[model samples]
Target: MVERLTRAVLAAPRTVLVGALALLVLFGLYGGGVASHLLSGGFEDPHAESAQATKILEDEYQRGGIPVIFKIDAPNRDVTADPVVGRVGKQLVEDLKQYDFIQDPVLSIWTDPVAARNLISKDKSSTLVVVPLDGGEDAAPGHAEDLAERFGGERDGVRITPTGQGKVFADTNTQVSKDLFLAEAIAIPISFIALVIIFGGVIAALLPLAVGIFSIVGTLALLRVFALFADVSIFTMNLATAMGLALAIDYTLLIITRYREEVAGGLTREAAIHRAMATSGRTVTFSAITVGLSLSGLLLFPQYFLRSFAYAGLAVVVVALLGSLVITPALLKVLGDRIDALDLRKPVRRALGRPERGFVPTEQTWWYRFVQWVLRRAAPVMLITTVVLLILGAPFLSIKLGFPDDRILPTSHASRVAMNEIRDDYERKLGGEVTIVITGSTDAAVDDYAARLSKVADVDAVTSPDALFVDGRAAAPRKSEDRHGEYRILTVTSNTDPLQDSGKTLLANLREVAKPDADVKFTGTAAATEDTVASIYRHLPWVLLWVAVTTFILLFLFTGSVVLPLKALVLNLLSLSATFGAIVWIFQDGHFGALGTTATGFITATMPILMFCVAFGLSMDYEVFLLGRIREEWLKSGKTRADSDHAVAFGLANTGRVITAAALLMAIVFAAMMASQVSFMRMFGFGLTIAVLMDATLIRMLLVPAFMRLAGRANWWAPAPLRKLHDKIGLSES
Candidate 1:
């Protein structure tokens, strides 16, 4: 089937090229407009209790719109009592009321003194004025930006700074978009240079870049299509561009290298293209499938943040595979001998009068020598590599997970600065507060429940309409009006940061405390974090199962060797464990503070899962590249133990340079994301770079050869029934 498809593409190169060009133009148009449809936040599980509570609070209780807070400071004066401050505050309130998006009766120091006590800063020089907007969280950013432009400045001896969730969201989106463009600008040129050095020809170098561009454009188009049915996170754009370019470069290197070798072996152009398609093309197809399956695990998580990556990854992999298998072969067939015509390095070699070295199996290459050394002392090499991998992975056991917050943004950002101030100054009221909604209960029952909640360890205070409870006792009559009909709301405040260990313990205690005759639901920052973590773990096992089962099946078909697939799985995991350890060390433990990042002492909960899928799939990709060449050599030689050793050395000699070059290009691409101001992206960039480097060098070069030598003929063993099944349906170039 692959040969027939290659023949058809080769038979109509011009037609295929034209059709691909048209599709590229169409997708480019669609991709250009995708940013407007993307979402800024998706950290919470949509079906979790916090999500349900948030929805009820918004729809049923009319608790909509994020607060646009203005911190007004007047030096050396009580802002609440100063004539100039009072006049300005009232005028600000009246002006806010005039805007249609602003909710009626904006809360300020002059409007309500009881609430104002919490809003006022401790020094009595500054107070907060909050204006609620008309829309949900998504609309808050735009509204906040507009309001900040109009009202965020000095007036009547008071200086106002606008800061809230909406403004933070807007700033983060803008920063990510900028970072994405910067990453592309840096990665593409570096990749091209690396490709040039690897291929030693300008035309050969540009082919992979062209495939990369096509993959990115097509993936963006697919993302736009998916956005019509579901919310896609803006972060997905970053992942899409990086994966598209990396995979395109990887697939193109394998295909073009094979085609060049076949041509140099005196095969006709058509036959070379056919053989290349039959082998490298088939491998590229299965590699993309394996990658797509790995990313599909993200779809099982409830957060759009994870699902968005799934959408972006699968789209890019599919598009990259098509570019490699179909369009690339067609281009190769058309280019023929001219593919080597643009050899910029040829002049230098000619000046030195050195013979050109083509990619053929030889004993003199460093890859062959290295494999021979490993085979000679296979046991010691394997043991040392295993110990190193395990030590690097040890830090992951101490990793602490948390949800992202304003801290994800750069410290210089206005929203981040404002949020830091709020967290420091308003610790009692705003920070670490748990909101509980109780339905189908009487007001007395709700009050009693609030009292019980206040008794929980670490609870500072509990506020309800009926009474204010402190240390499980009624301290004062609550002056706030009842905002309940069939349900009541209670606020539980604590001293610990909600995203930390103490806060998690407090949440558990709150859940453990009993409430009578009410359906109690908790929603707030800490509660939401707990729920999101729970949701991810609940579905993580299924995702791992799916990836494991599908990857094994695909590898079995690709290699017709059961043992090889298991070995690949173990090696990939070892490489990933080292990467995870590096992440925990640098990002979580703050060991690399000189790298210009602030460590929060905790890793983002979603990052490990996302990184595992991406890095593991990429490792599997390189695995297939090496195994395909070894299998080809094994088939050509006799299937004896000596033949297996010969095949290992021969395959490494032929393909090891290509694997290292591809891995270097991929690492460079991911490393460029380290320039991102966001901490998560930096961690992602660093972790992936380490994973690629380790896989390409240690695992592929040293461990794989040694393991193959040890396994001997058993490397190709399979059950009789499975062997028959594989022979009937296996994919092979021969």
Candidate 2:
């Protein structure tokens, strides 16, 4: 199949180039508009109980909860005594009524002064005007952005700063968009320099960028098409851009390096392209499939935020695979010997008074000698590296998971500023209130339930239809909004942030309280977070199984050895564990003060899953590259322990530089994400950087060769039936 494709490509290289150019233009034009169709929020599981409860709260109770909380401050003066504050606050409520989506009765000190006492700060200088938008989750952030733009600034000495889940999500979406552009701006130039240095020429350095452009634009166009069928998260765009360039460079480097090796071996440029296609081209195909399968694990998650990565990853990989297989080869066919033009190494060679080196590496190469040294002391080297990996991974045992809040945004953001004010200056977290609904419950039963709920630890107050309860004692009569026909609603306020341990414990205790069993449902930020985390964990095992099974099978087919696949999985886990531990120490434990991020005390719920899939797949990518060359060399030599050692050393010499370069280039792409304002983006960048570097250096370069030497001839071992199966289907250099 590759031979046939190579013939078709060599026959019409110019035609292939023209087709790619045409696609580049079309995709570029359409992909630019993808932002219009993306969503800012998709972290909730739509099928979870909390989601259903939210529907009831919105439809039956006419309470959408607060999307935007406006902190109205009078600057060290009492709000009631300042005429400007009173007039502006009243007018703000009136202005809110003009928006049809805003719930009919906005909550503020002016409108419900008695019930909104919790909205006032302890000093009486600041109060809140809570605007509850009636739209569902998708439209809420857009509404918040509009409201924040219109009424979020100061009006006659009364400052109105908006903050809440809605505003925070909006800010996150906007920041991610900016970070995407900034990350590219940073990654592209640095990557070009790295590419030039690695390839040792200017012309070859530009080929990967061409592939990157095609992959990115094509994936964006595909995502825009996907948006028509389902809600896609804006975060998917960031992944697409980063992975598109990364995979392109990885595949392009291997293909070009192989072609150069073949050319230096006295083959015609056309024959070299064909030979490179048969070997490196096959590796690219399997590597992409391995990555796509790993990303498919995200589909098991109910959250669209995760599933969207599956879509983005598959699109980028497929597009990059095509660019690598079709576009890269076509460019090579056209460039031919000129691919080595404008050699960047020539100037260096001149200054050193040396001649240019050819493509072929020798036994004197650093990787060959390095592998020999590792083989001599295989056991100790293996044991020491294993211990180091385990020690670095120890911090992952202490990982705590939570959902991101306004803190995910920079502290300079308006929503983050407002959240900080409420956290420090306000006695009550009005935005942190939890709501419970019970249908067909008697007033007596609800009053009893609310009283018990109010007595739970960390519960400040509970308002039921009968009366407001504070610490199990009735304080005042409740309002009509608390009752709707036979359905009773209770508002539970806590002094702690709902995302914290105390608040989660409070919710757990509330669930333990005895109720009428009349379809009681909890709906609020805390409830949604609980359900989202549960949904992820419930399907997490299946996700891991899918990634492991698919990857093991793919590696088995690629290497024709059951032992190699098993070893690959174990090594990938070890490296990924170290990466996760670093994430906990830096992002969760707040040990990296120079990163300028606020530690949320827990990793984001989906981050580990997302990182595991991406990093494991990429780790396996290098695994395949190294193993492919070793397998080729092994098959050509006699099947003996010494022959196996020779194959390992020779393969490392041939491919190590390329693998290390690809890993270095991939790391550079992810490292650009560290410049992002969002803490998770920074975590994502730093974590991937560590994973690729560790996999390339410690796992691939040192541990793999050492372990292979220890295993000796068994590195290629398989059961009789499986060996026959592999002989029939395994990829080879034939």
Candidate 3:
């Protein structure tokens, strides 16, 4: 198959090259244009949900625009009718109007009057003003920052602080943008270096990133076209670009690495390229299926965040596979022997200039020797590694997952500043507290039950329009008094950190409180956070289980041995776990904080699980690539397990360096994402880097051989029934 592909590509190298170039160019142009469009204008402010809601609220009530709470502080938390305080407050409102982001700031006590009780704080020091948003739906604080600066950082005699739903959205948009871009930029260069080390040739090294970049840019174009028809969030685009780059580099590396190996094995350049396409291309096809299927499970959760993410991820992966499987093979055909140009000229050349012929046992083979020594000490090493991994993974046992927060930022960010500021100023309002909702029953007993809740504490004030008021946050509105009546609402606040407690205590309390009331349902911020975590966990088993099954089926067909498929699964899992643990330790467990973010005990709510399914599937990709070589050797040697192991070992030793290089490259690409200020992305970069290192080092080098040695005769198992089926339908390298 490879030979055929090689022949065709070589027959028209220029044509093949040109065609691939054209495809890449098309996407580049389209993506650039689309990206330019987005940059030129702006997407509607999804963050300003609250600000938008305020306007709607005002319109409904026939009142004014949403009121902005002005926090006026004297040296102390004093609110008074002090002449200076009143003058500062009045001047502040007037000065705020001069800033365009501030629609209109009314100063007089008349509009928000003392009778209206618009004085939010006890000391007549602070007051609320009604302000309309100045721009269209896209208006944000980022656009207003310059204007604010122009008017002087402080307004009037008062320090200007903006807090509300609109401000929150503007803040979220700014921070998310910084974090994601930082990670994306960092990922590319690091990944490229890793690739260079793997391929030993700049051309081979650059290929994966090249393919990834093209696909990424092209995907943007594709999505732009898609965007014309459906509503796609800008956030989705960020995620898709990331996934595309990572996978493109990944899929490309898989295919190109295989192609180079085939070339080194002495196949004609064309044959090598063709064979690589036939096999590596097939691996990509399966890989894409596995990734797509795994992501599908996210849809069941019903959050647009995850739902849109699923679609974007699936699309990019598909795009990545197409670029590697189709476009890469053609390029390989064109490159032919030139693929080895650098190896022959540089390190290989330097080593070959000696009488030893530059052929020395690789570190993998050397590590195999170390393993032999370790086998004598295997019990201790195994026990020690196991203990450490357990200790590393233990944080997950107490892991607390919760809704997103500013802690994920670098703390220097405005988002973090704003979050901290709000938390401090409004502990009374329980600002940023998750909303607790009991939806099941609207029975009058609900009010009596609610009274039970207000008494349990963490209830700053509770108001039930029909029900009695106990303390917690402001008066609870009747779920029935409005459409919200069918749903009773409870506002809960805790001094304890929600993410750290894992939100379990609050959830438990809510459940316990609702138990006596029949048909009780509780939902709120803490509830939502807990539910999302539970939702991830609930779906994880199926996702990983299906991934394993899919991998086994694909490997079984790819390699006619039931034993091989099973081996890949076990070995792959070990690699994944070790990698995950290492990352957890480094990023989540606080092993290294000076360089970047410390892990948040629990990684971003969904990433560890996502990495598991995707990374494991990807690890299977490299596993199959090299395993195929070993399998061929076994079959050729008349099923002698030892001979096959040697062949496998030799193949691994020969290819081991490149595998490590590729892993390093991909790790670099992933690590570059670490530059992102966002904690989720930062953790992702760290975790991915660790996973690649584990696969390329421990699993591929040591564990694979050790496991293969253990499997011995059984390692080549092809059951009679399956063997017969294999004979009928299997695709063999031989």
Candidate 4:
């Protein structure tokens, strides 16, 4: 199969070159506007999930369905009751009271009746106000926060805590935009250097980078179109680019390495390219299929965000795979010796002539000795590592997932400074954040319930709103109209995290307190954040599980051996688990000092699973490149398991230096993300770097062969009936 692919790569070098060029042109035009024909940027980045969700909420509000809530909090409750307080405080309170778009802030003390009751506070020591914000179509919500700075009027104690559709949109956009650029900035330089170093030849390395870039552009363009039918998140867009870039390098790495080997073996440039392709191309195919299948696992999830991410991710990978195999081989064919054009260092020449190379891979190294030692203790080593991973990963078992309280912060950020002010100082005045619900019977449930709600909890405040119906239409008081019943607006406050456990617990209590007296539903930033976090967690495992299983099957089909596929699954998982531990250790546990950010309690939540899927796909580079030669030896010698294992390790030793070099290059690319201010990106960058290091060293260099030694001939065994079937149809490396 390898020979066949190499032949094909050699056979039609121009066609492959042309196709690669075309894809580049197409994708460039699509994203950067250099290529005029591929412009796909009218809407939001189609892969960014937060953008899609915001759009949905926008649509809901526009339809006159959900009332917008605008919450305000002022600091320093004590030094009150100057004439200026009545004048400025009353005016600010009045402005919100008259807002047409703003609905009753269910638990605010600043609105009409609620404010009246709370402002006097029995001793008349303080005053408060709730404002209704009803900015119609395309209200620039960011402007509202600005309103706070304006209304506070150089005063320290008065402030507004905005919470409405506009705030949500503003916060989401702010976060996504920052991460996107941060990721690009941190990744690109490191990635470029990694590419240059790994190839030793500039053009050779750039090809994969070019492929990855094109995939990013093309997939975004494709996603823009898909957005008509699905929701995409801003976070997902950044992630897809990262994913595509990593995968493209991985695919190209396998093929490039194979092509170099073939060229050295004396094939003409074209023949070498073909032979490399035909062989490495199978690896590419299997690798792509595994990655695609794994990402497809996101589809089992109910959240539109995950589903959208899955589809977009899958599309990018397919395109990257195509570029690696169908397009890349052809480019290699034409480039011939020029593929290594930037070889100013004369590395190959130095390598071929010298024997003093400390860098060259050899069994005499300490690493080789360590592998030998580990091999002798394989069972014990494996068992110990497995137990360690399980214990470290145990935190996930008791995991409580929820959207962040300060969604805008990585917890270290300062926008959260604003939230701290509200939660601490503001809560002293009102025991908790308020949740206002307008409730009533089918006749006048909303109005009556509003009044009932005011009287329910720590109701120190009351907002007696004028009769407001769900729609603008007013019901006749004496008529049989359902909306004619009395409606009173009320606000109640409580203390809670609103997104995490304490918040959820408080919410449950609040619900139980209010449910018996009125027909009411409590939905606010805190509650909604909980739902969002729950949604991601509820579906994440399924996404990962399906991705792994599907990757297993895809690998099985590619190798045509059930045993080989199972082995693929195990190695990938083992490496991934170790990676997760390292991520937790570095980012959450702060195993290292002052990583330049406050350590959140856990590895930035969503990153572990995403990293797993990504690393599994990338790890296939070693799996295919190293194992290809091993399979060849096994088929030829038909020897004992140990012999084949030795052959594999010997081939690996030959290739190990190059692959380890590549892994180092790649690890640098990932680690560059540590330069980002965004904590999650840093976590991802660090975690991936660690994972690649382990994969190249421990797992690939040591564990795989040691296990193969243990499995012996059983390693190659498919079921007996399946053996003949595979022999009849399978394409073996042999």
- Say which candidate scores most in TM-score: 2
Candidate 3 — which residues are off by over 4 angstroms? 1-12, 32-153, 163-172, 175-204, 222-267, 279-301, 307-309, 335-388, 425-429, 432-446, 466-468, 471-507, 514-521, 579-591, 594-603
Q: Which digits, one per residue and each the tens of the lDDT, describe model 1 over residues 1-734?
A: 67888888988998998899999999999898887678777888989998898777777665635667787878899886899988888888877876777754466778866566677777778778877666764576678889989998898668888876677767777888899899999999999999988888888899999999999889999999999999888888888889999999999999998888888888998888888888888878878888899889889888998999999999999999988877898788788777887897878799999887655447888888989999999999999999999999999889888888878888898778877777776634454778888888887888888889899988978998788898888888875543567878888877778878888899999998887777889988889888988888898899898888889999999889999999998988888988899899888888868156778778888999999999989998888888888999999987999999989998887889889999999999899889898889888888889999999999999899999999999999999999999999997746
The candidate with the higher lDDT, 2 or 3, is: 2
lDDT of 3 by residue, 1-734 (tens): 44465456567767876877788788777765553222211221222322233343233322223223344544443444556656766766666665554543343353544222423444444544434454432444344433333332353455545443344444455555665567667777767666666667777776788778877777777766755654444455565666788778767776776676666677876667677777666656665765676565545433444555566667787788767765677777656667656653476666777542343434346644554454445345555554554564554444444455446666775435544554554323322233343445654655666566666645433445353356422253443232243454444444445555535575566567644444343444445456666666766676667767766776777678899888777766666666666655665567767246645565556566656655775576568656765665677676675575566665566556556665666666666666766666566666666776777776776666666666667876887999888888876654
Q: What digit string (tens of lDDT, one per residue) describes model 2 on residues 420-479?
A: 988898887644778897888888888988899898988878998779899998988866
- Clash number for every model? 0, 0, 41, 49
Alpha-carbon TM-score of each model against the true structure: 0.95, 0.97, 0.77, 0.75
lDDT value, candidate 1, whole model: 0.85
Local distance difference test, per candidate?
Answer: 0.85, 0.87, 0.58, 0.56
Q: Against the correct fold, how does model 2 do in TM-score?
A: 0.97
Error of 2 at 655 (Å): 1.4
For candidate 2, list the clashing residue pairs, or say none. Answer: none
Candidate 4 TM-score versus the reference? 0.75
Considering TM-score, which of the candidate structures 2 and 4 is the better prediction for this target?
A: 2
Q: Candidate 2 — worst ten consecutive residues by lDDT sum?
A: 355-364
RMSD to native for every prediction?
Answer: 2.2, 1.6, 6.3, 7.2
How many Å off is the CA of 217 in candidate 4? 2.5
Of the candidates shown, which would achieve the greatest lDDT relative to the real structure? 2
Number of residue pairs clashing in candidate 1, backbone atoms closer than 3 angstroms, sequence gap of 3 or more or interchain = 0
